[model samples]
Target: MLASLLAGLGLGFSLIIAIGAQNLFVLRQGVRREHLVAVVAVCATSDAVLILLGVSGIGVVLQAVPWLLVVVRWAGAAFLLGYAVLAARRALSPSGQTLSVGTAASPPIPDAGGTALRTRTTLATTVLTCLALTWLNPHVYLDTVFLLGSVASTHGDGRWAFAVGACLASLVWFTALGFGARYLGRWLDTPRAWRILDALIAVVMVAIAVSLVLPH
Candidate 1:
């Protein structure tokens, strides 16, 4: 049982920590200290739910309905392309938003009676973007439902244990990534670093979008 759980945990971590768009977005938010908890919760929860669905035989059902994938594939491709453009614009014009760890340590300052409203708006926008990043991507379904689910099924009765282990892995990873990224705040304190990161995000998004549409 321990071995099965460990296998699931290890595989889950390997799949998730691959520096993809979602991971990058989470890390960026973590460093910025903006809606960190909501971002982590949504990502980890989404992973857990998707992995369990896959392990519970939804992968087989998806295989039976090929049209679903076709719809998802095109939709995901469109989303990714749109995100890539945003990333590219950001890269060209760095925001310098996350470069200062000082702002977080300091107490809140009066801001024309608009800070609270802005905070609420920012939080909502961040959560919605995280959701799109998590759910709108076809790769999530492919990896969590089809790939991981098929692999879990091979474990027979141990697949449930494996699913639990995978869920734990998601929790561990997103938690670490969301919080641990704060430490890197010291390193990413420059416009150059932010620009480079955004550029890389653009490249990654465009590449993945192309892959989604290309014949496989």
Candidate 2:
């Protein structure tokens, strides 16, 4: 049991630690102090659902549906490409004003000047964004559910143990990442910092899309 748990933790961490759109979004939200809990919750829950499905033998059924994967692959590629273009546009666009970290020191507040209102908006946006990112990407399903499930299934009686371990790992990682990003956000308060982040995200997204579409 201990071995399985350790293995699951390793697997989960390995799969999620890579830089991706979802992680980038979560990090951004964390930095902005916008719905941090909601962002983490959505990410964690999505992982749970996918991990559960993968452990439950649904992966085999999905394997029989190659066309579905093909469609998803194209859709995911398009989404990534679109996001990349938007990022690049933001980078290139001229701005008359830039926000400085010193200026952002004011405590975050909603348009209504209430913490509650701000929190609500943050939560809603975070959940929705996570859902879209998780569900839209075909690679997520293939990697998390199908691939992981297939590997775990080979363990026979240990499959359940492995799944449990993976789930726990997911919970730990998202919590740490979501909250930890808060510290990083403090350092990235300058407009220049945001611009750099946006540009980097765009590059990463486009590169990943190209890799997916043109795999060797």
Candidate 3:
């Protein structure tokens, strides 16, 4: 049982550590110190729900729906491409706003003389963004649902235990990432730093989108 739990935990963390839009958004929010806790909660809860669905045989249902995967792949690819373009524009444009980090209890504000845009990192947006990011990309289902579920399903009566382990891993990882990013934000407080990060995120999103579309 311990081994199974460890295996599930390892797999879950390994899979989520990859560079993706969801992680990028979370990191950006952490740096901005804007509703980081809400972001982490949404991410963790969404993963738990997905992991549960996967363990409950929804993975098999998705596998049976071939066209659904195709549609989702295209949609996800488009979304990634669009996001990359937007990131690039932000990086290259001089009109980008600068961000400042604050404590978890207070909201971060824009630099002096800059207009503050209403922060949209509320609980509703967090949940919606997480759901779309996790579900709209069929790759997520492929990984968490199909791959992880297959492994867990093989564990006989221990499958549920493995699922629980996987869920817990997500909870820990997202919590750490969301909070840890705030600590790392100390060095990334400048506008130039943000531009660089945005540029890097653009590159990563474009690269991943291209990889998805290109022939394996």
Candidate 4:
């Protein structure tokens, strides 16, 4: 049981720590300090739910209906492409507001004239975007559900322990990532920095979308 749990923990981190759409989005939200708790909660909770499903043998059901994944793949691709376009636009033409990390609830967005503007990334929008990024990506299903499930099944009666470890991994990683990005934001205080970040995000989104649409 201990071995299985450790295995799950290791594998979970290995799979999740890579650069991906979900990670990138979380990083962006963290740096912006917009709905940080909500974004982290959504991502961690979603991963826990998916891991549970996979450990419960839902992967079998998923495999039986391969078309479901195909449908999801296309939908994911479309959403990713749309996000890429938006990111590209932000990179090309950024809003005049500059980031101001504050101790208050909602940080003030100060423009060149020092006027405070409401944050553009609202709670509802942030939650929805986080959800879409978590659920729409077919890779999440493949990694957390199918792959992790298959690995867990090998643990026999210890599978539940493995699932628990994997779930913990998701929670830890997201919490750390969501909170840790604020420190990174110090370097991204300038508009040029934001533009560069957005540009990179756009390129990554487009590449992932293209990979989804292309033949395996």
Enumerate residue pairs that collide in model 3. none
Off by over 4 Å in 2: 96-123
Tens-digit per-residue lDDT, 1-216, candidate 3 = 877788889889888887787888788777766777787887788788888888888988987887887787778778788878877986876644354333465444644556442233466665666566666676677778888889889887788888888988988888777778888766775667767888998998888777667765
Better of 1 and 4 by lDDT: 4
Q: What is the descending lDDT order?
A: 4, 1, 3, 2
| Model 2 TM | 0.82
| Angstrom error at residue 115, model 4 | 4.7
Off by over 4 Å in 3: 99-127
Decide which is better by TM-score, 3 or 4.
4
For model 3 the TM-score comes to: 0.85
Q: Encode model 4's per-residue lDDT on 1-216: one tens digit a residue.
A: 999899889999999998889999999988888789999999999999999999999999999999998998999999999999988987886452354243365557765687664355669888988888889899999999999999999999999999999998999999999999999977887777888998999999999999998999
Overall lDDT per candidate, in order of appearance:
0.81, 0.74, 0.76, 0.88
Q: Estimate each model's TM-score.
A: 0.85, 0.82, 0.85, 0.91
Instruction: Note the residue pairs that clash in candidate 2.
Output: none
> Number of clashes in every candidate structure?
0, 0, 0, 0
In terms of TM-score, how similar is model 1 to the real structure? 0.85
